[model samples]
Target: MTARLANKRSFPHPPHAPPADSPALSIFSPIIQVFSRELQRQPDFDLLLAELCLDHVWTEPSKRDSKGEVANKMFLSHNVLSQDFANFFIGSLGQLRSIRVVHTVSNITTSGTMFTLSCRDAAPIRDGDLTVVLGLDNSISFYSGHVKCAVAVIAR
Candidate 1:
């Protein structure tokens, strides 16, 4: 089995991947709401991959770029932190396009960070489903959080 990251761990795949006809998933809704409330409390903010398809090349790695392949419909922000709750799915736009935000933060004055997930054609997140969550830090960073334990969940 191939590893999702340097760490050899896997989660539900193609099966969990939302079908082309499925609705947008809101697995990140709660997290979105939490950040929304934070924005209400603070002064402001701003913001912004894909491995939907697996490629295997021993020597020269095969990479997929949405721009080069417009026909490639499946792309996403794999919420590994959430145990792949968001799983694999067809996104309205690629991972980067999926998230949006405005920055209005300053150490002396206003402070806040909010990002919007555009699920234009995504599916609704079911109860108990996993999704991405954010982490607050002393300094701004791209991603945070760790997987205390990650057991593989391969396709049967």
Candidate 2:
């Protein structure tokens, strides 16, 4: 039997990236990309990402500087044993701006540590949907509970 050749199929090319003059994508691109990969890998990624995003979107506007910018502050206290660990973790908060250690009560524990941090924003948190904020994940948690505790305290 004789065989016939078929023409190659063509698909349309995606439009070019937005022009530089265009307004930048609100600060949620990285979060979207990372969460997208996570979602592809695991079914529960959305739940995890959603929970984490909640903390970022929750903030108090009462604590702001004269310029009306959020001036987040932290209260870190630790015993001799936890001093180094605490400092190291705090240092991990890279380029920490609008945040400071306003109150510190040292020697609060014989061999433990504590921190009370509050994070505010220039604008009030949105009622629904992801509110994009930059530099949120510059710091990472070493221990299991560190991130959750920090987020909870900051939101409060």
| Best candidate, lDDT | 1
lDDT of each: 0.32, 0.31
Tens digits of lDDT, candidate 2, 119-153: 22211122211111223533322221123222221
TM-score of every model versus the real structure: 0.15, 0.17
Q: After superposition, how far is residue 67 of candidate 2 from its true place, in Å?
A: 2.7
Task: Provide the lDDT at 75 for model 1.
Answer: 28
lDDT of 1 by residue, 17-47 (tens): 7654454546666787998888788654443
Per-candidate Cα RMSD to the true structure, in Å, reads: 26.1, 20.3
